[model samples]
Target: MLLTAVAPAVWGTTYYVTTEYLPPDRPLLAGVLRALPAGLLLVALTRRRPHGVWWWRSLLLGTLNIGAFFALLFIAAYRLPGGVAATVGAVQPLLVAGLSAGLLGDRLTARTVLTGLTGVLGVGLLVVQPGARLDGLGIAAAAGSAVVMATGVVLSKRWPAPAPLLAVTGWQLVAGGTVLLPVALLVEGPPPSSLSAGNVLGYAYLTLIGAAVAYTLWFRGIRELPPTNVTFLTLLSPTVATIVGWLALGQDLGPLQVVGGVLILGSLVFAQLRRRPSPAPVRAAGGPAAVQDLNA
Candidate 1:
């Protein structure tokens, strides 16, 4: 879990890096670069490709988790302020809980529901500001991103990969990057003619750290942990982003933000705590009851 938590924490740096170093208004290009290079490098390193079913599965998961998610996120970022986008996207955990309950047959407990709601509230307090304008399309995009991401999380848990962890991660990234490449070329035109040192460094950071390292840990978590449990950790992304902004960029960190951070952390902890089941009655190994237990 600690390793998994690092993914979102790394992601939190994206906003600052993008603003400070990346080319302006090139989200698709950024997405492509972040996903493809890391993916190709992983694939080359692992030298593993998807078998019969996984090609489609990789494509679908890639589209849902990375390609479509990035496109919608781009729209939301363009139309909505950062706070509004973050607040809207905070519904991811709740959505994941619901999907897990329906698809994975996980229990829909009150604690889980409340924790998810509290997470949204916390994120709202942490980021959403007063007088934030709403665009219907942008709101839709944000909500869609949450839904697709939630579905991706649940589906990934549902479909355990046959390939090694890094190989599977690489396949998804490659597929996602492939999906984005044409769209980026058509929509945003070609890449910028000249990239500064900051641009190269920023892209390198995002590709190597954000996509490659972060996503490997994330998928490993999904393979090992419950879907809802993993989703709760996602709340950390925005919280970390806010802190990065405050410390690195000198953004405001008001009292409300502090409370919000506390709430987010509380929810994360609450979700991870599970009630221990009562122990089975002790019995002799060679007794009739033990024979009955073995028979049953």
Candidate 2:
């Protein structure tokens, strides 16, 4: 739980890392760097390779979770106002809750639904500021990214890989990075002629610690916990991002953001409290055969 809790907090650094450390014109390059090398390193350490259905599954999961999602998210950030983009991303927890119920057959308690809604509303209240123009295309892209990510999360829980968590994450990163490399080269062009030391350090941190470590921990948490519960952790990301932006980048957090943060955290706690207990076992009335079968 501690690891799970810490992972998203670490992930909150993504916006700052991208804006501050990475070259501005190469979002795809940033994605590639974040994924490929870290993936290869994990694969080398594990010395494990996936085949057949696992290969296809990993590719699909990677495309949705990383490649397509990252592409759309970066585009949205570039084209849309930050607050609008963030509001679109903030809808993910609700999407995850709904998808988990349909796809994973998880019980969708009213409390869970309400909590997810509250989290979304809180994030919206926190991030949307006056004078921010909503770009329709960017909003669509951001919302699309959230939907794609939510699908990946649900599918991951439904069809988990038959390997250690790190190995699975490694393969997904490899697949995602491979998918992104060509796009990066074609669309963004070769990275700028010169690289800054700060950029290198930031890229390295995002690749090794952010993408590799954070994702491995996140997927492990998702497999072990309820999808809704896992997604609730995302609330932490925006809050952390807001703080990092303010302190590190001199971005301001208005009163609305603070209130929104409170609501999101409160919703998470409420959802945790509303967790349903396991159903009690029923006694068999017919015979011992029934009892044995039931036990089996």
Candidate 3:
């Protein structure tokens, strides 16, 4: 769980890095750099590759988790403030809870529903500002990104990969990057001709820590933790982002933000109280609480 939690915690840095360090007007390029290089590097390192049904599955998961999610995430980030954007994305747990009940047949326990609602409420306190102007396209992208990823989380649990974990992870990264290559070029044009040292360093951090390292842990946890439990961990991302912004960028931490952060943390801890780790061997099927892997 600690390992999987690292994925979103690392993701929390996205808002700051995108705004402060990355080259301007190139979110698609950033997404490509974040996914493809790490993926190809993993592909190069791993001797194993996808087989039979995995090609399409990897593509679909990759598109949902990284390609479309990343593209839309950037759009929302570009359109909305990070606080507003992260608050919007915080709905993933609720979406995941519903999807899990439908797809994974996990019971919608009272604990799950209550905590999910409280968690979103906490996030609203932490991030959403009053009278925040909304953009039509941005709202659609943010909500779409959440839905795509929420669906991907459920589907990944439903279909456990046949390939080795890292290999399966690499395949999705490669597939996601491949799909985004043309879209980035056509929609946003090529990678910027000039990149600052901070930009390069930020990209490197995202590619390695955020994508490769973080995603491996995410899938590993999915193979171990319950679906809603894993989704709940996403709440940490915004909290972490908010804290980081407060410290690094000197963003103000209003009283409400503090209360909200505590509430979110409490909700996350409460959700995990019932998570008993599974000792069974990995298998193709996801029984209720079946260990599955990978997420946005």
Best by TM-score: 1
lDDT of 3 by residue, 1-296 (tens): 88889998998888788888888788898899999999998888887778888888999999998899988988898898666777788889889989999998888877788898888889989998888878888888899999999988888899998777888789889999988889999988867778889999999988998899988888877878887889899999999888898999898889998899999999999988986878996465565444444221
Q: Candidate 2 on 16-71: residue-level lDDT in tens?
A: 99888888878889999999898898899898999789989999999998889889
TM-score of each: 0.94, 0.90, 0.90
Tens digits of per-residue lDDT for model 1, 12-32 = 889999989999999899999
Q: Which regions in candidate 2 have their CA more than 4 angstroms from the true location?
A: 276-296
Looking at model 3, the pairs that clash are 219-294, 222-292, 223-292
- Give Cα-based local distance difference scores for all models: 0.93, 0.86, 0.87
Question: What stretches of model 1 exceed 4 Å from their correct place?
Answer: 279-296
Better of 1 and 2 by TM-score: 1
List RMSD in Å for every model shown: 4.0, 5.1, 9.6
Query: Which ten residues in a row are the worst by lDDT in model 2?
Result: 268-277
On the 0 to 100 scale, the lDDT of residue 145 in model 1 is 96
